[model samples]
Target: MVSKEKLNRINELSKKSKEEGLNTAEKEEQHELRTEYLKVFRERFKKKLDSIEIVDDETGNNT
Candidate 1:
């Protein structure tokens, strides 16, 4: 999971972006934070999908 502080920073940067604009460093930071967040999210989602067990109702077998 992304740290709470990083998430907060991401939000702050986003709001700042919409309100005014970001300096180059801030833009880079935001990109890195977002990339990390997406990477973690995709990993968790893939794990959840891998754990899913589908069964055939009639035969009571896993598919």
Candidate 2:
């Protein structure tokens, strides 16, 4: 999970973008934060998928 502070910053940046817009540095920071957030999210999702077991109903088997 992304840190709470970073998440808050991401939200702040988004709101600023819609309202007054961001400077170059803020835009870069937002991009980096979003990339990190997506990376963590994707990793966690993959871990959840890996932990799932598929079962075959007809044969009473698990794969």
Candidate 3:
């Protein structure tokens, strides 16, 4: 999971971007933070999906 501080930074950067635009360094930092956030999100989502147990009651089978 992304840390709370990092999440807050992401939000701050987004708001700054929408209101006043970001400098080159800020844009790069935003990009890096967003990438890391997405990567972590996708990994956790995949794990949740992998843990799901599918069952077919009509066929009396578990898949």
Candidate 4:
């Protein structure tokens, strides 16, 4: 059996962790939404590059 204060502390930490987990999940969802928004713009930008000559920066060769 645990002491009353120890048990209370454990309970408090549990609640705190639960709240933190929810906050982290919310942030992750927001990040994913921002990534998807960028993806839409990236696709549009790719169309403009198709006609330009592509070069590989790593090897200094045409890709």
Candidate 5:
């Protein structure tokens, strides 16, 4: 079984990964817009995801 300390570290890393992923995605979309590669699509997709309720499914609260 994972130790509590290790579990907490894993959870922290997971949260960081999610935030990093979102940042990278935003940058990529920005580049796509600059290059005229469906800027509207990129913006729309990001907008939809931004509107998502940031809740853990099981806990029904923020992660």
Candidate 6:
């Protein structure tokens, strides 16, 4: 999971972007944070999908 601080920074950067704009450094930081956030989210989602069990009631078999 991404840390609270990074998440907070991501929000802050977004607000700043809409309100005024971000400098190059801030934009880079925001991009990095977003990428990290997505990576973590996708990994967790994949894990959940992998854990799912599908069963056929008629055959009493698990796939």
Writing each residue's lDDT as its tens digit, candidate 3 over 1-63 gives 999999999999999999999999999999999999999999999999999989998997887
Q: On lDDT, who's better, 5 or 6?
A: 6
Better of 3 and 5 by lDDT: 3
Q: What is candidate 6's lDDT per residue for 6-62, written digit by digit as tens? A: 999999999999999999999999999999999999999999999999999999799
| Candidate 5, superposed: residue stretches over 4 Å from native | 1-37
For candidate 5, the lDDT comes to 0.58
- What Cα-based lDDT does every candidate model obtain? 0.99, 0.98, 0.98, 0.60, 0.58, 0.96
lDDT of 4 at 4: 60
**Candidate 1 stretches greater than 4 Å from native:** none
Model 6, position 34: C-alpha lDDT score: 99
Give the residue spans of candidate 2 off by over 4 A.
none
Worst lDDT 10-window in candidate 6: 54-63
lDDT tens string, model 2, 1-63? 899999999999999999999999999999999999999999999999999999999997996
TM-score of each model, in listed order: 0.94, 0.91, 0.92, 0.38, 0.34, 0.86
**Candidate 3, which segments miss by more than 4 Å at Cα?**
none
Candidate with top TM-score is 1
* Residue-level lDDT tens digits of model 4 in 1-63: 334664455455456567764366655654554465567668768876776788899988987
Clash list (residue pairs), candidate 1 = none
Ranking by lDDT: 1, 3, 2, 6, 4, 5
Whole-model lDDT for model 2 versus the true structure?
0.98
RMSD of each: 0.7, 1.0, 1.0, 16.2, 16.8, 1.2
Q: Model 5, 22-63: lDDT tens per residue?
A: 366655544544344345557778999988777788988885
